[model samples]
Target: MLRFGLVGALGIILAIASPALPAAAQKRFPSSAGELTVDTVASGLEHPWGLAFLPDGRALVTERPGRLRLVETDGKLSRPISGIPSVMARGQGGLLGIALDPEFAQNRLIYLSFSEPRAGGNGTSVARGRLNEQGTALGDVTVIFRQMPTIASNMHFGSRLVFDRTGALFVTVGERYTQRDQAQNPANHLGKIIRIRPDGSVPADNPRKPGWAGEVWSIGHRNVQGAALHPDTGQLWTAEHGARGGDEINTPKAGLNYGWPVITYGVDYSGAKIGEGTAKPGMEQPLFYWDPSIAPSGAAFYTGTAWPQWKNSLFVGALAGGLLTRLSTEGEKVTGEERLLTDIDARIRDVVQGPDGFLYLLTDEEDGKLLRVRPAR
Candidate 1:
């Protein structure tokens, strides 16, 4: 069970220190659909970062300390599955994202993203492996993709994996914090979205120009964490972390410039202005932005039937704000906003819709938990 006393105290401190929203805006938005019932499905996880459900009704969860565990339908976590590649396991850098092969039933393949340590420095790397029939260890593990220009910083490894309907894969990355200026450059993979085939080969129709890296899909991103495919439009949407303010949600198009430091609604940590203003020509604007900075991580477009009114809403996990934010969208624009799970006071790491029509959340803490959300009885 969660330590309510300690968690509550942390929540109070976060509420007092949060500068992103005004006092009035910080007030919880009461759920209009019904009271939410939150249950602790699993606990004692060490900073669980990503989650992926398997074809057999079990799930795979990755810990930031470089271990992966299998979770049963009843929330029982198995012993750490072996055969994962070595990881750097530093601040904000470790095992980050996981995804199952679209044809997992036949191939039993899985993919993982982590901070790989090298002779010079560390960089985000992706690997694929086939799950052995015994379900205890991986077979044929192979490193597939590695981010370019590996740096020494332990921060800003924005690694999230998502597969489009066409069987192509998208990888999100961050501009190593000190290398913010590199976000606008195209020669490297820093601060860019990468598109490639499942086997880590460049797609023939990739939008990179003559001087840009062949895997680049979009440029000028800071550190993108949350990514999801629109349920209707089938476009790729991402949530990016801002420096001080200016947290943004964007639908990244192929070969486009997103304007990270050049144009942002946020400023530096010292409260200095950023860029030449919020708007500029040639750079793409955000579909939605947060002034104070919610520090959004994982996101999913809800299509579940359990919450009928929330069927089409976008659910985003907020770290600094310590809540689950629900945004109602009209086409590409966010029309309304609501915040949930504030009373729990935990930093939400990732959110995903489960196969059973409920929402699952991962809390970012030493004693992280897997929570299931449903309508209160």
Candidate 2:
């Protein structure tokens, strides 16, 4: 029941209690879109991860512990909707991302990404189901995609789902910490962006040859968590975590190599060198990178008119940096950067522009919150 003003105070206390960011990681800039205010829409969520608004103004929220709930327009949360598949729920793995079908109004279909457990081990997976008419459960659930080479390690499940204009689903996958080299292998799904039809079939025009596993769109990513289709160009952009540094924002191209372990701006956890260097012969450089990692999560392009200055800008949630990053872009290039909500001191997990022309964010914590952001009157 804490209010927004009280939440600000709580954030300040949290900043004081937590360890300070390193000098290189302290990159806070003033917002250019004038004064802004944050309102707490809902609280007491257990590590809320993904958010998607329904046509009726209610929002579908996913918690990392594998529960899905509906948040009413007035911020009341409904009981956990039934019919969710069992998730592995291990370290850095659980129910991760959720998205509504482009034609959800008609089909009532929804998609979810999670860590799926199997006999050998667990891997990232995507499932589709129809929301029951009573909104109490899901029906006709089916797993559409599963990451290949299921490994035991629980970290580095790079999962975020986005649908392209043509109705293809783009899925991000991570290189399961110990499987960095596999990112370069076309035979596996680790460290790659894969595009598939809603029914789990590979599109004939996929970049890979017919013999290759027809799902991979690009390769050599580290642990991508944030993904969005560019509002202007319709291109796919992603934000991924690095080892110690080298957090990157990239626009993935078909069949291109991103050069993760082979070429990285980050070093190992032990301060050892990662790749040959930041550059290699055929790898593509990121549109932007953070030297000290921000640990970015979900992302959205601000297409709302409520904040005209933010229109077409890219907003990403920062986990380690504890802020919302606004990247000003000119077409495909990032022109400027600003860090917001630093005073909130919450690990921002997701950012979505609401249908009502406001921005919504999910804070990651034991007592996570759904926050609304708008221009101050």
Model 2 worst lDDT window (10 residues)? 6-15
Write model 2 residue lDDT over 82-185, tens digit each, in one string: 99999988899899999999999999999999999888889999999999977889999999999998899899988999999889999999999989998988
Clashing pairs in 2: none
Colliding residue pairs in candidate 1: 20-292
- The CA lDDT of each predicted structure is 0.82, 0.83
TM-scores of all predicted structures: 0.91, 0.91
Q: Write the per-residue lDDT of candidate 1 for residues 288-328, one digit (tens) a residue.
A: 88867889999998886656666668888889958887777
Candidate 1: residue 330 lDDT (0-100) = 78
Candidate 2 runs further than 4 Å off? 1-30
Q: In candidate 1, what residue range of length 10 has the lowest lDDT sum?
A: 9-18
